[model samples]
Target: MVVTALDLVLAGLVVGFGALVQGAVGFGMALLATPLLALIDPAWVPVPILVPAMVLAIASLLRERGHADWRGVGWAMLGRLPGTFAGVALVVLLSPRAFAAAVGVVVLACVAVSLAPLRVRPTPPLLVTAGLVAGVSGTAAAIGGPPVALLYQSASGPRIRATLAAFFAAGTLLSLAGLGVGGAVTVDGLLHGLLLVPFLAAGFWLSGPARVLIDRGGTRPAVLGLSAAAALLLLGQAVLG
Candidate 1:
């Protein structure tokens, strides 16, 4: 596929903003970027978006490595393995519009759950469950952060960012591998992702200051609001298309 300069600029701006949000909150890059990227170009969904997401995850993890909950990450990874396989299957089976609609539903559901009065703790079992859900969503649609982020909503900002960063860093690799096995990894997708890396770096740099604002009690609202907006946009596009 031939991408024009305009496409690159639009994608860069979307990715940069997504990276900034993810860097500050630890889980919005894919959640915010995937649907928007898909809207820009259907070919950019899972693999291309996953590449920058992986970069952001590694960067966030490095910045807050000491605060991550290793045990929780381990449990999540355990579930991610099987879930990734399922996600790859969906990727192969679904049409682009169908996939977008499905992702929209998942994000909306997650937002509703987060807004509810129920309190969720990141116990071993729940972490595994979140990981499983994340694997499927992240692999298929690249919007896997909400499930895990909800579990850590009440935790300190640094811990939430660090732990999620660790989970995504490994989980994204697993998803990419699954996509490769499923024959969903394309050279065009990779090149597009590489083109967006500099934008991601700029976003990550800006996030250093943004993190302070998030830490001052803006995390949950930001997560929920951005998620809902993206989900709505995705669903609208699917229906209209």
Candidate 2:
């Protein structure tokens, strides 16, 4: 489907809002953007969103490069490759209706997991596990950060942000390539994704000033609220589609 001007404006707003959250919390762009974009048009999931997500990931990583944990990033990448391929297989096999439903389920599950009081140490084995989960979740639904973010919740804020950003950057690229190989994404979809870059950049820019506000408190509630709303929308689409 061709993305109309109205679609571009709506998607830009959604991407901007998501980028705001991500700028504050380090890892929620997909969780916030993917489901809503899917509602706008189910075609917006996976690669369309993944393309912009990678760009955001790179920007975030570069901004916080000093704090990035290279060792952790390395381990995560190890698991992400295989898991990404698995997700590619799913995209190839599943029908659009089924895929939409599954994306809804993933959004809900990720929210549930985020709300749970689970503490995870970012060990190599654990990082690999999180990476694997992230790869599958991200590639399938563009909601991959929860797994890796949960593991890094205990780390210093900057470390958590930078490392997760790095993982996402690498993981998103792999997912995109896999999607390309599977013929699930096309140049048009990627171009559509690129169109949202200006909005994403705007959000990222505003995030710098707004960071202090979210840093104090309310970030968790805000993130959960957005995730829940998006999840509901995605569920509705799945049921009605």
Candidate 3:
């Protein structure tokens, strides 16, 4: 479908909201964008909407993490590559509804994982394991944040955001490359994803202040809100069946 002006506006707003959540917690670009955009125009959701928006968001997101998060990011990237290839391959083979349902299931599982206890802080080995899981799940589903997110739940605020951002940045770049090589990315997807750039920028800017709120100490609300919102998005899609 040629996007109507109203559809553009709706997509823009959805991008903005997703960005806000990213600013708030340092993830959620795909989490927020995928479901909402899918609801709007399933035609656009797969490549047009996700491919470019995520590419831009990841590019902008990684600057701050730099040297600090490299080791973990590297490990995650290693696993993420093959996993993402597997995911895109699945996308090619599966029917559209099957793909959407598969994504929904993975996302919902992430929500449940997030809600569980992280009382025992993560060790390096755990981070490595998370990276492997993230790589596979994200490659297939395009929702890799949960695996890394769970890994970082016990860290300080800055560490959490920076690490996750770095992981996403690298993983997305890999996924984008694989998708492009597979000829999964088309001009239409590029244009649609490009249109959401403003929203992505807005989210980046908004993160500055949200970072303050995050720095103040309490993170229960942020975690709770994201978990609920993500789960709701998935459940809504499943119920629409």
Candidate 4:
């Protein structure tokens, strides 16, 4: 498939904005960017998007390395192993429309849980479960942050961002490896991802200011709102397509 200039421009903007959100709130890039990128070009999902997401994760992690919860990340990584395989299977088995719809459902469910008054502690078992869910969603749809982010909604902004960054930085590699083994990775996807790197960098840089506002009691709302909006858009696309 030939990608037009307009496609690249639009995708760059989407990725840049998603990066800004993730950089500020700790886990929104994929949730906000994936459906739109899929609309721009279905081939941009998963591999291409995961590339930039991984880069942003590393950047975010380094910026707040001191605040990360390594124990939580370790537990999450444990579950990510099996979940990634499941996500790879879905990619190989489902049609694009079905996959999109499934992702929409999962995201919406996560958002609903996040909005409820239930308080969740990041216990080892819960972290592992969230990691498993995140692995499947992140690998299949490039929107893994919500499950894990939801677990840290009430935490300090730096901790939330740093911990998620650690998880995604490592988790994305696992997903990419699974995709490559499943034959979902392609040269075109890698090239497209590289093309979007500058945008990701720009967005991450701009997020410095936004981080202040978000840290002052804005994290939970941003995470829940962005997740819901993106999920709705994805569902609409699936239905329309």
Task: Give the number of the best model, judged by TM-score.
Answer: 4
> Candidate 3: where are CA atoms >4 Å away?
51-63, 66-68, 94-125, 224-232, 235-239
What are the runs in model 1 whose C-alpha is more than 4 Å off? 94-110, 230-238
lDDT per residue as tens, model 2, 1-241 = 7888898899999998888778777878887787679779977776778877889889989888999999999998888898898778776777656765665676567668766876446789977886886777678767777666766665665676688789888889999888888888888789888998999999988877666775566555554565566566557756777
| Candidate closer to the true structure by TM-score (higher is better), 2 or 4 | 4
Instruction: Write the candidate numbers in order of decreasing lDDT.
Output: 4, 1, 2, 3
Residue pairs in steric clash, candidate 2?
none
Question: Which one is best on lDDT?
Answer: 4
Alpha-carbon shift of residue 97 in model 1 (angstroms):
5.2
Candidate 2: C-alpha lDDT: 0.77
Tens-digit lDDT string for candidate 1 (1-241): 6778998889889999988888888777776676677778877777888888888899999999999999989998888899899888877787757876877787788778878888768888988887887888788778778777777888888998999999999999999899999888888888888899999999999999999999998877876776687678668767987
Error of 1 at 50 (Å): 1.2
Tens-digit lDDT track for model 3 on 17-132?
77777766767766777777877887666566565446544644564555246676677666676677777777688654565465556555655766676353445766666676
| Candidate 3: C-alpha lDDT | 0.65
* TM-score, structure 4 vs. true: 0.92
Model 3 pairs in collision: 48-189, 80-135, 84-139, 87-140
TM-score of each: 0.90, 0.83, 0.81, 0.92
Which segments of candidate 4 are over 4 A away from where they belong?
95-103
Worst window of 10 by summed lDDT in candidate 2: 218-227
